[model samples]
Target: MNNKLHGPLFLAILSTLMAFASLSTDIYLPAMPIMANELQGDIELTVTGFLIGFALAQLVWGPISDTLGRRLPLFIGMVMFIIGSVGCALSTDIQQMVFWRVFQAFGACTGPMLARAMIRDSYTRTRAAQMLSTLLFIMAIAPIIGPLAGGQIIRVTSWHAIFWLLVVIGGLMFFSLFALPETLLPENRVKISLANVFRNYSMLLCNREFMRYTLCLTFFYVAAYAFMTGSPFVYISFYGVDPQYYGWLFALNILGVMAMSLVNRRLVLRYPLENLLKVAVTVATIATLTLALVVKLQLGGIVAVVVTIFLFFSMNGVIAATSTTAALDAVPSSLAGSASALIGSLQYGSGIISSLFLALFRDGTPWTMSWIMVIFTLSSITVLLRRGPLPENRSSLN
Candidate 1:
């Protein structure tokens, strides 16, 4: 990597790009009810639409980035994102909102997907892990800030302002992105073709070590997104938490993420990544189980819900950085884009499932959220422990 592109500013730009997905979703979450009442249809459509676009678009962006190099595909995606954001801000009905949300996500997915490839292009395994941790640490700030700022914005203005705010963010980040050097060298680039894309992805799908980590990471994301999809309604409508105060509670969970990210950054130096991952998974399982127990027994009220959710969400700090690094490390450098796309596509794709689960089984309580989290957490743990390649055997397996 160029020295000019390996400083704080470089990390900031990459992290900001990565934050686009979370920023676009979290900022409008507090105002979802307002949007729903005014728009007169299922507001969950916005979330589901974004998740679908985010999930599927990465497949295209990843291959295109690999072929064309990262910068061109990235700039094009940002332009799409900007146009979509403007459309969202001007939407007159739920149908239009859903369309633009999907469009916005099509562009938004490029940021994180390509950012991961860029990181892989720059560093080896351990260094990549550390840099990813640091990237996540910076990126975590968006979730902390988004809902808080969103809550205040909705108090005085319509939810349209929220999309406008996203437009401004997209514009600024689009310009800031120019400073990032193209990490994928020309000599390393591959040709873009449907057959080529299919073959590369097929190769990744058959790699046991790669699939294990990717699947585990995808499960964790599903669990967390399930919570995100349902929490606003659970907290505000069910528990009567004020919308303005929702972000404060949300920040607590994200703070847990930042704290755990820092811890993972240090622990990676002294501990095997597998060990760190195991412990994180165990802790996450326990937290979700406890949350289920709390919500079932009604022992902790909202206090218990927040604390347990905090613990469950905090493990994201370790799980996301470590699992992603591990999965990417299992593949040849040429496959980084496809690996990232596969991982991202599945992770976000599961959100649609989570959203549908809540939509169908929800009973106006927190039970559906808790159940989905538990199911996915258990699925992740099972994959990591029972199916994942053993540490000593990973080299041969990959």
Candidate 2:
């Protein structure tokens, strides 16, 4: 069944599955202020709650997928996602919205977590990096479209319509899986047990190469997630940009992502992915530092902030794809699901921290956002540099 699937269709399915997280998170962002006002609660809690659920649920899904094969767990997850979206649509207050968002994430996390494992199931290390970059290139369109659609929906109807739209997306994906072949073979299945789950996860944590690569990407992602959480306030609230036009500025960053992912597809053929990862992180750190300074000094107002933020985000094209590919490559094939989950868990976990920072430092300015981005990008670079050199040839865990 897997053999019969065409490449482009297969990529589209996986990309949409992975893009589910972004689509879920970004679509309601344009309505944050209005939602907060009407619901009499902070809308940011919904994002934090979703991240918390998204982070922890991946641990359960990853190992379950390894045991049960990919398709069954995904079917279960999509149903949960659809139900959660409906719950969100019907929520009467921010607390209810947050609760349902968390529930929605329980199902949504399965998409990207399994998507990475599925990619690993099909490709070798270098090929996986290239394929993931291409997948990201396609998936990047979600953020570009999400907020635009959200803003329009709000203008005509209510923020509740956004969740209704997500319900439709979840339903389509649930049906789409019928065509997706189960990638995990019977021969590759591991027995489900508490002891085995702990052992496999322990082995991954003890692998220095895996941890280094994982943390490098994870820290860099803190910056990106920070941008996602903070940008609406910075652009629309602080700078007084109209809510409808907010999507245009947001689209600029995603266009940079698409451009860099396109460049990465070509560059991977000529350069080692590890080297590319290092260079991308360094460039991202520099851009973030400049952004911090620009916002602190009020250097060029919103133009400087947007340009620098665009440059910083563009590096995600290379950093995210290569780092995941390299980290999963450090482990055995059977651990791919668990490895993907741990990577995702750590990445989304940082969002909780980002949300907290914004809340604690709620200054009605971009200061907190800019600094958080800089600090995390620097942390990623520090992790990458302090690790020193790697062996030209390394052994994977047995």
Candidate 3:
């Protein structure tokens, strides 16, 4: 049962599935202000609703994927995504839109969480990192094009049209999954029992290395969510940049991720995953602190801000792939699905908290945003330093 499909084809399918999750969030970002105006509600509240919906749904989907197997949950998730997109398109009120967005996120979680687990099931640590880098390289195109596409869609049609576009993408992905072979073996599958669920979760929770990497990854997401929630306000309201211009800024930052991911893919073969993660964390800490200082001093304009963010997000491309490979490597075969669930929950759970903090401290100032990123980056570095380095070989974990 050599389940390893052609590398390029596997990557293509994985990237498409993963990109659907992100496209659902980011493609509509440029339209947030528009959605607020149309729905007759505060933009912040509407945005918060979407984030909340997305984060909360992760808990349910992960356990389901672990119990039921990857393919079915993924199919159900895609269907839910399509339905949510349709619901969003038909929504007439903010509350209605919020409900549908929650529905949407529930579906979106299937790909990112399960996809990582699937990669791990098929490949070793170094190879998993390589595959993820390639998958991320393709998935990176989503953020680059999503906002731009959404912007153009908004420019030409109503915001509802964006949801319609999501519906179409979801449909395509659903059809594509029909050809995607199940990567998780039956011998490895866990039955959906409450006691078994808690037992597996306890195993993950008690592992020092798993906790360390999960926290490290979570903090990184916190930093990202902070910037994402604040950047539009900072760029548009304070700097007087038009919303459409944000597409280019967003695209440029993603390009930075793409560049770093390619470099990491090459470097992972020579340098250890742990070493790469350490370097990435260190660079990210410095970049984030620099961003904070620049904002405090009011040094430069949008270019400075964008460049700093680009550098910050570039680190994410490396750290995310590294931490994922590390976490998945730590899991025993029997608990791989549970391990995947816990990691996904931690990452999105941290995002939920970070988004809350961003909302609370939002004074419409760049300083507030920078401070949040600084806090998250420093926290992640602190966790990694305490844990020391990751084990060099996956075979040792077994």
List candidate 3 segments past 4 Å from native. Answer: 1-4, 191-195, 396-398
TM-score of each: 0.97, 0.97, 0.95
lDDT of predicted model 3: 0.80
The lDDT of each candidate is 0.89, 0.88, 0.80
lDDT score, residue 153, model 3?
Answer: 88
* Worst 10-residue lDDT window, candidate 2: 389-398
Per-model RMSD to reference:
2.3, 2.0, 2.0
Question: Model 3 TM-score?
Answer: 0.95
Instruction: Write model 1 residue lDDT over 42-157, tens digit each, in one string.
Output: 88889999999999999888877777788998899999999999999999999999999999999999999998999988887777888889989999999999999999999998
| Maximum-lDDT candidate | 1
Query: Candidate 2: misplaced stretches above 4 Å?
Result: 192-195, 389-398
Residues 78-157, model 3: lDDT tens digits: 99989989999999998888788777877877778788878877777888898888888889999989888988888889
